[model samples]
Target: MSQVLIESLSATIVDLPTIRPHKLAMHTMQQQTLVIIRVRCSDGVEGIGEATTIGGLAYGNESPESIKTNLDAHFAPLLVGQDAANINAAMLRLDKVIKGNTFAKSGVESALLDAQGKRLGLPVSELLGGRVRDSLEVAWTLASGDTARDIAEAEQMLDIRRHRIFKLKIGANPVDHDLKHVIAIKKALGERASVRVDVNQYWDESQALRACQVLGDNGIDLIEQPISRINRAGQVRLNQRSPAPIMADESIESVEDAFSLAAEGAASIFALKIAKNGGPRAVLRTAQIAEAAGIALYGGTMLEGAIGTLASAHAFITLKQLTWATELFGPLLLTEEIVTEPLLYRDFALHVPRTPGLGLSLDEERLARFARH
Candidate 1:
């Protein structure tokens, strides 16, 4: 008789146009495509997860198609016979047996946890060492490009009671010019809020210094990825001199990167994304590194739908020290949701779902409507 054999793993690309346009230095969009991966055990237990492919391939070096194909053609084969519950063993095997594609690896990892949790009738957060916060404080994004338009967007979010923290996108314009725009938005919001900025690899060290000085004076809470991600010299330079605590976004992708960043005193904050860091356990390890170093851990998003959003939410819930506000407002950015019960947000807070597994239920109807092909 055949043993528990490797079965099938599959992916779907769901194109969800944002209900409102979300702007970043790389691109502006009213829509996003999520690479949703589903893996099954031979006995029919299944799990679902998401990988976000940003910027249509040109901007972020990834796409939904690439993430899905990597999972189906490369990663899934390695997991076919492996025990689904042994995530540590699975990850070790993944490193030895497969190559590096962190985003793709993360997508499959999420699915595995989803399957494992469902089998035990537990939420993924429980498996991650239980939860600390059932709800997360969310930040609203100030649209990029136009300063006045961004402030208007911020005001709109405030009117709707949708957010308490505001993240401004800075990078398309020169550093000084960008600060002018940033100042305009921050001033518009007045004394009632906190502001942060994501440079998105748009500035150099000198510019980072000047801009951070101005934003810091204007009450900016932090400066995210002030300089280019790949510039170690710049990371060190900015981390040492910048007035605002520097946060790593485009940089710090792996445990090695996390160790390097902390060892070199590259930044005061670590921004962890499940998609970029690869999976929950991987990000958690990174979190432990940050905590040991007395650094702040901030959860980031990739503008994902419910699947990826909830996956990150589960991880964030279990984290012992997520000291900074989170940007897990992907569902809010989308025009619609594909979850049966949406992650509830009130007073700028998002409640972690209490359901079992990754704690999300997909709406098949929405999937049918959004699938590009």
Candidate 2:
């Protein structure tokens, strides 16, 4: 075994246009900003990672700007001379100084894993306890907020055998309006697709109370984060009352949050996101907690590009069960790809890379084309 010393670490902000505006409860995203992390080792091997957020600050505390600043000003300095092969040690060094840059940490951790996997001649998934499955069923988000357009899009995906699980971004419209849209789409798709909704914590308890039952009655598979994440009492009430399974997304940020939700019986399902739970392995810890508490698993996305998406896929493939599938169609939403070989999506599932590392290599030309600088 050779000790690979970290020689350099850099973060770049890349702005890529989306195929269309992605509407959410808080903000509409017309483009995706990625905080791309590149780590080079003494052995001359380089690994790539990404920290991506939707609608920038509208979505979460970590923005592309903040991720880049934190990584360059603080985290990257800590990692410069460390042993890249000792990923835990490298991560711990950052944890001691940093508090809540989970997105940045995720990016760094991903790059570390990619480097280690390449060095070991294995895929990143193998390094993460080996993959239990090679391919993951991916879900597409219908965020156009147009009933007819969403229906048509879902039909097209189903017809093409691309995505059978559809997640509608609701709660932006009025309760009645959102319900009508959801129901209409569900009715149109019929049993051809599984329809779910992510409220993104837009509704109050009262609104969720009514909407949950209505959606449940209409055959919606799940309702995600109907109420705010802090409203644990509301979550508990909704979990007990709603016929549709309540999934906690904004609620479960860390392992501690997962335990709290599980202990309070706040939710029936948890949306496992790599950036939210710190990194790939950290999210796995959150998943383990959810699994022990009997909460169903959902592989959520931050609408990541290739680096972050594959980092997530690597971790998700190791999970024993993903009941609600995944929304890892992040890269597909972008107009351009930064990876040389884009992730393979077919038959309604995203296939894991068999190549060493994250099974990805950056397209420098595309990176230069989209680079914010």
Candidate 3:
């Protein structure tokens, strides 16, 4: 057995244009910015990772610029001479010095895992408790804001068998307006597709109280973070009464948050994101907590690019149960990808790679084209 020591760490920020404006309650996104991480090992292996946020700071605490700066000024320095194969130990080292830069830590941890996978000649999933499935059913977000356009887009996805589950981005508009938009799309798609809504925490308790019932009665499958994460009592009330299953996205940011939400009966479904929990391993710990407390799981995305998406997939594929599938169609939203071998999406699922590492290689040329100079 040989030790793979970390030689150098570098981060690149790339700007990618989305296929369309991704509208959320907090913000509207015309482009996605990512902090791509590169970890070079003494054993001559290089691994890739990504740190991305939706709508910049509007979605979470960490932004692309902040992630890049922290990685260089803080995290990378600590990691430069550490054991790349000892991911847990390396993460603990970073945690000792840094606080609450989950996205940055996630990127670093992902690169470490990727390097370990490549060195071991096994896929990242095998390293993360071994994968139970090879493919994951992915859900698409219908954020066009236009009812007609959203229905058309969902129909095309269904027609091509690329996606059968659709999530709608609501709460930016008036509650009645958003409900009308969702109802129209659901009626048009009918039994052809499953429709869900993510409010992004735009409603108050009273607003959500009305919206949840209306959405559920209209056949919506789920409602995500309708009210604020701080309003635990409101969340508990909504969870107890809403006909549709309540999913906590913004609320459950860590393992402690998960346990607290479970104890309070705040939500029935947990939207799991690696970056939110600091890394793949941390998110897995959160998932275990959810499973133990009888909470269902849905793999959530921070609208990450290829590197982060595949890192998430490698960990998620190893989960025991994914009741709500995953909303990992983040890369598909971008007009271009930084991966040499683009992810395979067909038959309503994203196929996992059997190759080593995160099962991805960087397309340097494409990355350069999108790189922020």
TM-score of each predicted structure versus truth = 0.95, 0.99, 0.99
Clashing pairs in 2: none
Residue-by-residue lDDT tens digits, candidate 3, 182-242: 9999999998889999999999999999999999999999999999999999999999999
List, in order, the clash count of every candidate structure: 4, 0, 0
Residue range 1-373, candidate 1, lDDT tens digits: 2333336678888887776676777788768888888887775778888888577774465678887777777777887788777777777888886655777778888888888888789999998889988988888788746777777778877888888689887787666787878777777777877889998888877777778778888888889997887898889988888778899988876778898889989999998888777788788888888999988989888877888888888998887767787998988777777768777888788888767898876788988788778
| Candidate 2 C-alpha lDDT tens digits along 47-73 | 888888877788778889888888889
lDDT for every model? Answer: 0.81, 0.91, 0.92
Better of 1 and 3 by lDDT: 3
Which ranges of candidate 2 are over 4 A from the true structure?
A: none
Error of 1 at 258 (Å): 0.5
Which candidate do you rate higher for lDDT, 1 or 2? 2
